[model samples]
Target chain A: MSDSDAQNLREVRAIIARHKLGDLIFLVTGLLVLMIAVLTFIALFSHMLIDGLPRLSWDFFTSFPSRRPGSAGILSAWVGTTLVMIVTAAAAVPLGVGAGIYLEEYAPKNILTEIIEINVTNLAGVPSIIYGLLALSLFVHQLGFGQSILSAGLALALLILPIVIVATREAIRAIPVTIREGAYALGATKWQTVSDHLLPYSAAGILTGIIIGLARAIGETAPIITIGALTFIAFLPPSPFKEEFPYISFEWLMAPFTVMPIQMFNWVSRPEEAFQVNAAAAGLVLVIMTLTMNALAIYLRYRMRKNLKW
Target chain B: MQFPVTARRSDNTPDSSTLGYNYRRHLSERFIEAMLFLTAFVSVAITLAIVVMLVTESLSFFKHVSLWEFLTDTQWTPLFDNAHYGILPLVSGTVVSSAVALLVAIPMGTITAIYLSEFAPFTVREMAKPFLELLGGVPTVVYGYFALLFVTPLLQKIFPELPGFSLLSAGLVMGIMIIPYVSSMAEDAMRAVPMHLREGSYAMGATRFQTAVRVVMPGAFSGIAAAYILGISRAVGETMVVAIAAGMQPNLTWNPMEPAATITAYIVQVSLGDLPHGSIGYQTIFAAGLTLLLITLVFNIIGHLLRKRFREVY
Candidate 1:
């Protein structure tokens, strides 16, 4: 070959090599970034496990919180979390589902509908603590619920309302338009169509949304704190059931309560080394609860997406 | 020839039973619709309630403390005997910590998104998706514990003088917590870039990396910007990690190494302390909360507008 031609060939190879090197560098960098996120997860979990595993036991689940770290357990915290979740679910589901149904099915494309849509989006972006302020003013003071389980539940219900509404709308929107038309052709009323076809079809997605919302609510501490959840509660709310004429009582709704995250926060803020261990234990439990809920929601979503042919 | 459908039905429905049944059905349907509308309106009610609550309480606060002092004062000592009401210290702490967190999250999250969307195999993507979800799913309180008890000590080893409650550790952990949010959203945006665009890039002999950085990144720029804005909102609104790991003292400083209270942590501190209702101390939290809400709202609006404006129909 001529010298000029050989030189051109060499320069072409050099350019290709340079591009290939850039690609390789980016590949390594991307892997490192991914690893950093994954490793943080592993590290956070293992750190809690190492510090907290020994603290998890039967006594730990049975006893109430105490000033002494050794005997302090999460009994009150767990019970409160459960009861608050019950109230939150009871309050949020009906309202959120109704709203979702209305927006997706009944509402026309109008200015009012647009306003409602924008409001839901903005509500979702509002900080959790602001919800606490709202609850403190509207529920605790005006509604006279005080710093009770009912108030906390109502606060969280409001906090997660947007999530449920969005999830329900997305799930409803996923159903083919033909289904709605088919129902209408059968002379089914709007409520009847929604009750029979739309809800049944979208039940799984709605449940996933509720579970995820509840999971988020359970971990929320600032709002609960702002609404004044007692940091050290030694007893559970009055029993939800009664032996009297009425087999069920709602008095527990008015009783004060504390939850898991607050319990962890309380312990973590302590200066003692022993409290830190308890905090880690509580942290482990909280993490497990949230992660399990999230995992279940994700699994349900995946299965729903896979199974639903439409 | 001009008879309407409703008039025809009315003329044909002669039986009393049919008329009664239709009337009952109409009444019930109307009732149900009203109920549904009311439920839908509850969300709007909530927004209104939040705005009213914050503004009224903050108005009460401003009555006690001038808006000028609240805006420009550097010290935030509502509970102290001297009782300065400046919000700048908290603002400074919030800005510095969020800046630190964004520094860590944006680059890492963008890189992770690009890798997952453009480079990772299907199996790797599947594994990473759940892993990232779990990472994000961990409660902020647990993150606070990790930051305080684990990360802070580890950092102290690097810088022996690093305080046990430095903003650096909390910000780092908060960034880690936010990575999932950024990466997932950005990945969705990049993946939404039409396949033909990538094909065109490859037709010109561009490598996968080049295609992602050049063609896809620009295509998804608005979406990525939205994702970053979301990360900023989350970092700014985050409470528990800073409350537990960063000191509650509202020091007006920009150094991330020094401990200071963010807006969120200050609210938590005040909430934990017992201040009677209607007290200036109590009202201070509302003012702080209003500030926090306004900051997040601005970012959220920008993000929403960006997503709306640049959403590719293709």
Candidate 2:
């Protein structure tokens, strides 16, 4: 080869090396950002856990709030959260699961069904605050629910309905078609086949979805805030229903309550140092609850996948 | 001709009792089907309700303020006396923060995805996947606090002029919050790329880096773009982080060291207090919400369409 040609080849190789260097820089920077994000989460949790442990005794779990920071336990908030979850689940499960079953099994593949599917997908991404506004308008002002747990729960239920339905549909779809065919061959009706076979087969997955959905609902603050869940309720919820009389009636549902996230928000917003500490503590509790629910979901999903037979 | 008349009639007639049973069963099935249809109808109703309500409220808002003033004005002092109704500053803040976040998130997330999918061992990839998802599962409020208390302080050490609640800190944390979203989607896209393409590049004596950069990355570009758009939507609609870390100042400055507010943050600020019905300030919140909702809706729709368009048939 000529000397001039060899020089040209060297130059070309140098340019390629520079380009490779740039790619390495991009890769390194990207990895660094991800590392920072992970570290931030770990730091926050560790800080809260460390600061919160000494104060987190049995009394913290059982007692109600007091004038002192050390004295105020999250019992009221705990019970209130449970009440909200129960109410939300009670309203959302039947409606969401029924919708899922309908869409997956019964609904015709038509324009209307298409619209419904798109709407549900869009609803999943709608800002939580919008749901809060809807709840405020329809429940608080129009229906005269007046900032009660029922309104908050109903709003949350609506917020999570799309997610639940999507998950439920996935679970239902995972069931093989032959089971339904077998039932049909046995002279069983459509409803009978779904109820006796499909539902049971998909129960574990459905439960996992419900649990995860509930975890999401529990962490949600915007909708409940919009529905005016009390920032600090001194009293525990009376019942899950709205009525006082007719013991099991719906009238007991209209009682006011405070959820854990809302409580954390309220406390965090306060300028006082005590409230900040309280907020951190409350945050810890909320995280624990969410993590527990998440763990349960993972466990159930694993179990379901293992037991699922093709 | 010799057969008895009753026996001949019975043989010729259909079984009436069996027919009655079939008719009842059909009716019951129809009823159940109708109930199932009702459930689907309810989902539609929820969407309709949100759209209708936002439109009505926004219409009321537009009646008082002209669209030009709402969109063009630089100052956004809706709560104070002599309130100017311009939404530009808020929009600028939102855009700037989201852009900064995307700048940080896209490269980071895409690289991490590449590393996990292409480079990492199976065990390392398995451990890292959940760790990345853990970032997603953390509540936004916690991120908000962390940004305000931790990240802002850290930024102050570097940029001494940075305010207590500057756009830089908020943008950084928001970027961090969005990393998992982009990474997971990009990973899925990269994983979907046909292995034959990579093998062909390898046969041509391409280095691993060269193949990833030229072949795999280009193949996954559409999915990455979709992830980027969705990440922007999340940043735009994000409330708690911007509300806490990005100071509630509607400044039209481009500098990241200064305080600024976003549309979602502005809504949160307004919604905290009691605003009487029919007031311009209350109406403005709805107007702002309308803008936010529309912008995000557009992004989401575009992202969905792009994903559909570029989806690999295989």
Candidate 3:
């Protein structure tokens, strides 16, 4: 009787084992898929480091692009990149934050606000090249800004405006509903509550969004390219100061510019293998800048989440 | 008159208005609210301006090339010595690359999502997500650089027949670029599945893997589909990687090994070239851009609708 029972259990075990095989296969496949992504990224990063390390020198950072690969530096490129970023951040942050505050607080729950919400969502996903088209027509020709840093910055601001708005909204939403109600109870105006209480409370989160959005703006190449950012720029933008009493100058904004990504694009498009090495170095710098920005944003978000109990 | 009367009537309230504080505060508040509203309206204006800009330019372009001919034309060589305005070449190229990307991204991303949502330990999931997002944060131009400088060489070793610049590399790398997008969105959806449902599945003797695939995945299908479609739209609009790795020549062929030009790539090419502002050559790009925008807008709307539908259900 005992032997028969053992045999029946063995048969049941075999049946269960067959079903378990699918689970193992599925688990392994999932791990393998994730591994593929991790490995490809590793390979890409390491390859850039290897190719670019030799080219990273003081001269490389200080000088401008040259005809020879050995002499070409990213001075103009980095400066232009920074300037464009400054412009984009300046343009996008306040407007996006204001829009976000209005959408979340002041606007009534209605169809027109709904349309604005949808438009922002839709704009966030629009092919960046389309923004370039808009800029080319509206900014470059219609307004006659031409292919300048201001135009490129304005274009990127549009491209990233949706991102900033979404991030700001998410950040402000994380603040408790009770907080807003408390402001209302205090007889504070809506704007006062937002500017004094909400903005200060969500400042870190808003900064995080602005940083991430700027990080995204810095990495973008497509829209700027469409607006005719050059590959061969060797001069700095006009100085922002003058010999006159009024030192500040706005003319630099109108000057032609080429950002790091555009510079990389320019070099990488060359037929020469040497230029590819040049591209790698520029790519490395851009990657480092972008990654640091993202890491800072992530750290800010993590800290904000962890430290806040309510 | 009403403001001063109300200010004086409320004896319990502080008489700040007598010192001009209330008046100043009221004015500033109104000004700021209006300012914020105006800022919000700017975004709406930007959208309207985009539509206006594209349509007006496209209308002028259509005067030269009929809409039917532009749509039905089989070649797209506006820069060539003999011009052709057919958009099929660029459209096919975009479709092929996007298709290849989706085919690679969907299974890979979904599996990773399932594992992260249902199987991975907390530490592993936490560490993995940021790194995956970092991949997404990497610029498309960098992806393009990788595709041109590294991936093409790697693929050439395997296929031996693959071109230096082909849709194969761009599409595959673009898939990798989109993995975080798909996995993160899908994982969010799967995680949103009520824990009770998983407990119910477990009580019925279903394994975690079985429950994930059979129970949670179906419940999250709308979000997953939305994510997949959004990824497709991204791949379609992607410019740098395709423009860098895919060739400039417009080929309508479906073969990945062969070179093709995407709509974004065509726009890049034309803009990089010198053309007069008002000429047909310049106008041609706007028309192409209009087409690209419409195509992406359709997918985006569908994805949005699906997400809204999914949100309602939850």
Q: Output the worst ten-in-a-row residue range by lDDT, candidate 1 chain A.
A: A181-190
What is the CA-based DockQ of model 3?
0.65
TM-score per model for chain B alone? 0.95, 0.90, 0.92
lDDT of 2 by residue, B1-314 (tens): 01111212346656887666767777797798888888777888988888887788889988888899998888989888888889999998898888777888877777788877676667867777767765676677777767776788788898887888878888888888888888898888888899999999989867667788788888887888777886888888877787778888888878777889988778777766767655777778778877888988999888888877876655
Estimate, for each residue in A58-81, the C-alpha lDDT of model 1 and write its tens digit: 999999999889999999999999
**Total backbone collisions for each predicted model:** 0, 11, 0
lDDT of 1 by residue, B81-191 (tens): 999999999999999889888999998999999999999989999999888987887889999998998899999999999998888999998898899999999999999
Of models 1 and 3, which has the larger TM-score? 1
Which ranking of candidates, highest lDDT first? 1, 3, 2
Q: Give candidate 1 regions above 4 Å deviation.
A: B1-8
Residue pairs in clash, model 3: none
lDDT of 3 by residue, B137-235 (tens): 999999999998899999999999998889999999998898899999999989988998899999988888889989999899888987887788798
How closely does chain A match the true chain A in each prediction, as TM-score? 0.97, 0.87, 0.95
- The order of the candidates by TM-score, greatest first, is 1, 3, 2
Worst 10-residue lDDT window, candidate 2 chain A: A238-247
Kindly list the per-residue Cα lDDT of model 2 for residues A275-303, writing each as its tens digit. 66777787888887787887778767767
For model 3, residues A2-97, the per-residue Cα lDDT tens digits are 998999999988867876887788878887988899999899899999999999999999999999998999999998988888789889998999
